[model samples]
Target: MPMDWEAEFVFRAILIGVGATATMDIWAVVMKRAFGVPSLNYGFVGRWLGHMRHGQFAHESIAEAPPIAGEQIIGWSAHYVIGVIFAGLFLFVLGVDWARDPTLLPAVLFGIVTVSAPFFVMQPGMGLGFAAAKAPKSNIARLRSLIAHTSFGFGLFLATWSAAQVFQI
Candidate 1:
């Protein structure tokens, strides 16, 4: 029974993560079509990870980095994996009960807080500087990130709410 419960928990977490990440991607598409905002190139994320294997953590510009084999696939896979991990973290922090009956504020806050990953670790490591301070338009970049993460939070809520309704949890 305990194992079954654990398995179910893990499944729920993965579902929530994937759903939230997909929501963010949808938002990116909408932004691109409606406002001409370009989405982040996940290929760069793969390149950064590939370089890290060679002890090269920072790059002047990820775009200029030598392309790694299958970088696009690697980056997209990692993106989804990271999303699942983030959802797992969210579940751990909020507990299974939240998954059973999710709310908006907490999920949204968690999503917004996730922006710190890019602002601090991912951006600096990719040579964008802290919080994209070095970007051509840092403010716009920051705002976009905020909106994306907020959307992820909303995704989390939507996923959980839908799950609760379907699973009757």
Candidate 2:
């Protein structure tokens, strides 16, 4: 009972997403412990999303937004879901053949490219302005984002490479 290509693709995507996201989380933890750098509070993300139910898409300050019940859970879940979505997008753009024999450059480049989401969309929507222009420490926030996204790219390559080995893809 060998798995079909589609099924395998789904499994691989899930693995890659979770693995890459976990790698980002590990990096966050390391940054926090080593340099006292703070991580983005997913609670704010949840609150942002939660507000969508009330026809609110953007916030003046996500932090000042009223808390939504179970916002943390929602935000965390959304975070991983977004990761998985990105993985799927990566595969779609690169194709299944790439998954079978993954490379680093494309994965890392893609990860770096993904930073656009936060800089343009999420940041503005959360009231930080473009690329966190309104952030208290905008430059630091931008740099951290670049680093984090770069790590995510590395994670993508690592996950894909590992999956290729384990699954014999």
Candidate 3:
């Protein structure tokens, strides 16, 4: 019933979502290392520790340390994993068969929709408002957020395309 590139396989859509998430993680790491931008943070570790001590649930906070080689590796790995999982969920919702024929439109839209999870859970914990809305140094940061999300969407489409080719579906 869905418009997959192939009829017999829907796994390609899941592959696309996973690939896209991975692409974004890699890009984030490269940008952070090369351009001195901060990307993925493993603040969840710190947050969990905080909760254990305080017995109160708290949000994950962003790291304040300067990025280093090891940090980049660990952070980017986590980032990629998160992306893949999120995309995987979307693919599951779309149905494996339908995913085989994934169109850029749905995949990208899914990216946008999923971004809200980070906006609500991560952004505020990092001290930004819902969806990066309250971030100061406004103009550039806002533009950066917009571009980042858009890139994720594009990555999702690309991943889907690549998966389709690889799976021959």
Clash counts for the predictions, in order? 0, 0, 4
TM-score (all chains, Cα) for each model: 0.96, 0.96, 0.64
> Model 1, stretches more than 4 Å misplaced?
1-3
Q: Higher-TM-score candidate among 1 and 3?
A: 1
Give the Å error, residue 82, model 2.
Answer: 0.5
TM-score of 1: 0.96
Model 1: lDDT of residue 85: 92
Candidate 1 lDDT over residue span 1-169, tens digit each:
2336677689888899999999999999999999999999999999999999899999998988899998888889998898889999999999888898898999999999999999999999888999999999999999999999999999999998888888754
Q: Scored by Cα lDDT, where does model 2 land?
A: 0.92
Give the alpha carbon lDDT tens digit for every residue of 1-169 in model 3.
5445443333554466567866666677878889887764554434433444445433433454223345445545656666767766766677665544668888678767766765676666555657766666645565555556666877887877676666654
Clashing residue pairs in candidate 3 (N, C-alpha, C atoms within 3 angstroms): 4-101, 5-101, 10-96, 16-160
Instruction: Give the Cα error of residue 68 in candidate 3, in Å.
Output: 13
TM-score of 2: 0.96
